[model samples]
Target: MTPLGVFFLSIGLAVLLGTARGSMRRLVLGGGLSLGVAFFAFPFSRALGFLSRDALDPTLLALVPVFPWLALVPVLGGLVWLLALRPQWAAWSGILGGGGLALLGLLAQAQPTQLVRLVPLYGLMEGVTAVGVGLGVFLLRPFQRGWWSLVLAVGLGGLAFSWLNTQGHLYLPKMVGYYKLLLPAPPGAEEKLVAEYNASLPEKNAVLKELGQPLLRPIASLRDLEGGLPQEAAEAGYRLLQPSQLQYGALAIFALSGLMLGGGLVLLRRPSLWEMGDPKAALILTGVLSTLLPAFEATEFKLQKLAKGWPFLVQFVDKAWPPNLANPEAGIFPLQSVLSEMLLTVEIALVGTFLAAVCAVPTSFLAARNLTRGSAPMRVVFAIMRAFYNVDRGVDTLILALVFVAAVGLGPFAGVLAMAIHSLADLGKLYSEAIENADRGPIEALEATGAAGVNVLRWAILPQVLPLFVSYTLYRFEINFRVSVVLGLVGAGGIGYFIKGAMDAGHYDQMIIGVIAIVVVVNLIDFASSWLRSRMV
Candidate 1:
């Protein structure tokens, strides 16, 4: 038969066998037969060139001729049949299968390559097969224990592994390079530096040779500046900032402050703080600390360095203050340009929040579990929507702004698009939770009165959730406004753009003005959002 014909025949047989009501012996025999057919059909289709090699791994392709000897299909079918006889075994088998598939995916991600593309398709095929077997067993015998905790543990483990692996491959090397760049040069380094620079470009060296003592002039200039005041101070600062030069008094103070902070974190009686009594929360905290502590140590978080730099920081502040409010070319405590950009930032936030709210309203209803509970298809739709929300929120707003800037060209419009997309995800999640927790009585009552779905949603769900939605939107507006200001650093056109320009040009006076404007605008928005949420609640 053709590959397409074989594919349909295998699926039809499996479905028929799966739906058949029979004794344990009959079901197992039928299931084994179906598995054998599907296994053989897969190889046959691949051999016929109907299934692309790109879509099927070589290992599977090689297994076609040896299908009868493989025995994997019949063995798995037998295991499922045996598990169907015991509820405990069936549930444990499902949990194990799911966890194993997830771990395989994680391992594949850690070593991603062209081959990794095949892993997902292979995993999906195996996962579907396992789930189908589990469901068939479940129909014959149900296992009712809580399996959610097992799933959560597997998921968290996979995520933690992926994060640590990524950090090792990406962040650790970058950090090493950064600190190496900051290292102090040894004495008589000018000759070595000149040699390296000359060696890097032979053409430049040849030109310099023709110019008689070509390298000597540049080397002399470097040597002459080697004993400068700035160099001396930098060398001195580097020495003073070393761990060996850390004062005992500073160490004592740091230890005492840490102790106090740790005590407060443990003893504080607040709703926001994690309860020490909760084992799960404690475990999560421990995991976080375990991951962060090594990173902090690697970065060498030194209190003594801050203390040594205090004098330089003070001198910088002294020079930066006393605003240049007179010069038109550079001066302006609050420049007209800065004020207008701040206003544009606010408008971007407002428009973005409005756009997000409009998009999220309908999407949130589709995502809410309680609303989508009655239908299996709707529940699947809900899962897909929630996954999209997670992906949208997982990406940073600044990164999103950079992407949009590339597509749409740099301006406030790029910032607006970034804010709107990110806020859509955030507000969709918040709105869905609110909708899911809305009073169900009104919905049921409306449905009893023969109200249409739209009418029921309008009369029952919206009234209960609208106030919270409005309040959350205002709160998000405050957040997006701050984000918009930062987005300006990437050419998204806000106060941050001016701030970045000032910093690049060493115009601290202008930069300070822009900073003050942002602070004032953010504070005003915070106050307004707080009052609005309070009144709405």
Candidate 2:
């Protein structure tokens, strides 16, 4: 089916279902409003150059094959079974049909190759489905007390195990090799091993040289050449592994045992637990369990090594403190250069926030549902704008900076653009929410008079929301300032570039200076923004 067809059909189905659920008047009204909105959504989006005709074709074509297998088959089978045998099982039939359709719709967008890579996700889906099925069975036969609890518990345990196995965390082979290497070798083995190890260094260095790009070479060198147990073990013809290696199996066992114990406790306390009466509560419990189980199983929980590093931390502080208050040696990044770059970072945030605020003002109006009321075309436009905001905000500033760097090449310009784009989305959403939540009384009064749409917005809406917009813009500027420093690490040009270089060359003192500069600047901005926001509010 075409995208339009699919959309209308879905709406029709929703209307039908709503009618069946005894909400005919609401269903009809909502369906009409939805259709009206749909009528103008595509055209307006197209006129704005936001909608691409080519993109729609591929999406619709992908869904074509999915509809028959997922939608038609399940619905037909359900209809036949319901008519011929169990008339009372229509709800289950609808669930099966709807679930299949939803799954197909999700899968339609993913390439087969991508799907193959997501085999682990299939286990998660299956686990969730199994839980649902077990619950359904319980609901169908509630008289069989405690049966569903046991089923759900066992199913969840199996799911946890499956997820753990898929994550490769529970794989024993790698751990076994590391453990074997930790065992001591005999006297004769040492001399021979030393000869072999010396011979291997050139080969290892060659591999490192080949793999290490200039950008990553520092990290590679630190890992491969650093004076650590791993390095020592490698030279002695062995491997060194973290304490997690020994504790991993025990952690996994404990995690699974804990989950079972927790599940049992839930079952035993079902009557008192809120989930006993609420499916939503049960679902939330299941989700929480699923997440906690994997995290508990994978966590190292070993802190002895961390405790051992306290002395080194102190030594680092001793070397880096007082920050060379006098005329210090001008390294690659001189003090003057660091100070200038820090100023540039602040400038980037200021310019970016200003640009973002300018772009966001108009877009926020389009995105505010309250402002777009009674206008189907405008409501559709609101959704599109909201989606744009969501997508831009969802992408990280660092990732955006990288893209801008690729497009516009490295420097503060790239950082500025990246910050601006991210801040635009953030500020737009904030601005829209402010507009939506503004006093409707003022807007209604203006509209009731001879005020036009634009006049109503200008006179009534803008006055209420402008202060909030300014406050949010200031807050976003502070965030952008902090993020800009990190952007410079990726060659977007600021103090972070110097900091990254200091880190790469193991210049702890310089890194400390850079960090101190950031802290002072950020605190200043935070205080100023807070004070401004307080006054604005």
Worst 10 residues of 1 by lDDT: 112-121
lDDT tens digits, residue span 54-108, model 1 = 1221221233232223344335534543542342243333233222322322232
What global local distance difference test value does model 2 have?
0.56
Clashes by residue pair, model 2: none
Where is model 2 more than 4 Å wrong at Cα? 1-286, 296-305, 308-312, 325-333
- The stretch of ten residues in a row with the least summed lDDT in candidate 2 is 41-50
Model 2: per-residue lDDT, tens digit, 20-40?
A: 443222221222222222111
lDDT score, candidate 2, position 536:
83
